[model samples]
Target: MMRRYFQCLADRDAPAALRLCTELVEAGRSPVDVLLDVVAPAQHEVGRRWAAGEWTVAHEHAATAISESVAIALGARIPQPDPARGHVVLACAEREWHGLPARLVGFALQEAGWRTTFLGASTPPTQFARFLDDADADAVAISCSVAAALPAARRMIDASRETGLPVLVGGGAFGRDDTRAKALGATAWAPDARAAVRALESIAPPPAGPSVNRRAGIDEHAELVLRFAEFRDSARRRWAAVIGEDAATPLADDALDHALHSLSAALLTDDSRLLREADEWLSELYSARGGPSCAVPALWSALRAVVGEPLPEASRHLGLLRQVGRSAPRLI
Candidate 1:
């Protein structure tokens, strides 16, 4: 039953996650086990597919929200031991309002016998700093799904370090540059939130010895940098025009997430002209701006990543803008 449930999530089938959770509850399947195995692994699976472009961001989110809701249903059933190895504070950077991963980390950490404070995304840096000072957490784990929020992640890391707080940063951006993780002042970076639990355990007793490693030969992404720049800016302009500023600044996760997946049919079209058009359209997008739009920098960053090495800061800024998608509902 759990195996079938896992398959549904891998397929990004929302109804399956929810229905399976209900059945598992009825069948005496430990909610804790369901979340530990069924939800996290499934979430990771969907995330992997989304990265490979096999699934749209919307489908990934649908899978996430459904799984999160199920995890929430499990509730206090998540393990919580008084004798924890250490405590961690998890939050998203300001301007980055996605929090589903942090929420998942909160549950996953509990299962690992570590205490965690699930701080949702877009939290002000000042308040985040205060929380660390007050809570005296063993380490602070910051997350961001959108690449645009990375600078904010850097700021949070800087602020935490000023107070001697051990910090680890993770998310989509980290997926782009594991080395930039430390460059941003993070004590370390994890491929995923669950991996963070292992990172924390492996670090040591004090949990504050900061180690920075440069993953040599990790400096460039030619195609992403050169090819993606113009196209990314264009996409941002289209997104901004479609959603407008108010909706664009604080993107509607549900709407944008929905749009990404709904467009999968486009990905299925094999016409070379259509694909060429897609590529060319990105190049011409908002050409009047003279560069990539300010909205989706991460796409720019990820693109530059393909360019590899000697990546200038200007390129990162451009890529970050492309990370913003058409998440808002069109204002007709």
Candidate 2:
């Protein structure tokens, strides 16, 4: 049944997919089960396929829109119980535009009999804090889809903590085998919506420590950040020189920005594994966007030459890009 629903989504048949879910509910399947078991898996697969270059961004976006609609429909079908447990605020980190994970968690919270305020995507910290000021929330659940948004997440987490709100952090940004949330001062971490719901049920707020700037704490990372800023300016000027004058297009700009963002995020953890993984994913994403693989090699080499010996990860990443360039489509 889930596979059938996924097919409906891939076919862009929102109505049919909704109908299938409606029938599942009519047949005594719990709405929450359908959400967790059906909608969630389908959305995950959609993301995976997109990353694997099996589907275009348009197809992924269409499927996600339909899934968001389905989540709303399911929320309507499921009765919201009184706030017997507690009131919770759900939001994605600032600039983290993917909200489906937060949405699903909101629905799950509602099912668990908690009053939830879902702030949706790209919720600014000040704006979210303002909202929290007026509302009575026991906990805040922050969803971040990208590692690049962790700085924003840290800001939100700090703001929430100022109000004595216990924060539960979860998302793909943390990657596997990492404690990014706790490292950022979160009360607890939840890897998924189900775990988020459970975490909210029973989580003790940790003792607050003096707020620290995560980026400025590490000497090497701080230096790298400064070097990257200078390198970015040089790369822009030299882009036309290396890739041709026509190579300074938006696609090229986006690829460079992506590389910088990923590398910066990886700097936070100083994890070599994460740096390599991020570059691998970025290479795949760049290719998926029809970005020339040559751009990856070009950008990495430029950064290496400009930044000097400070960032060794750039060398490792450049190796990956060179391998990618070997088999990728030629520049147009």
Best by TM-score: 2
lDDT of 2 by residue, 1-332 (tens): 88999999989999999999989999999888899899999999999898777888899999999999998998898676763588889999987999998989888888888888899999998898899898888889999878668778878888888888888888888666436676677888887878878888788765776444454324544565677667687766665567675457776676666666666665555444444555567667767877765665566666556544656554444344445534223211
TM-score of each predicted structure versus truth? 0.55, 0.82
What's model 2's TM-score? 0.82
For model 2, what is the error of residue 240's alpha carbon versus the real structure, in angstroms, after optimal superposition? 7.1
List residue ranges in candidate 1 displaced over 4 A: 1-19, 22-33, 40-64, 204-332
RMSD of 2: 4.5
| Candidate 1: 10-residue stretch with minimal lDDT | 262-271
The 0-to-1 C-alpha lDDT of every candidate, in the order given, reads 0.56, 0.75
Candidate 1 lDDT tens digits, 142-230: 98765445546766887777777677777754544455575565777787646877777765332343332232212222223343445
**Roughly what TM-score does model 1 have, to 2 decimal places?**
0.55
Clashing pairs in 2: none
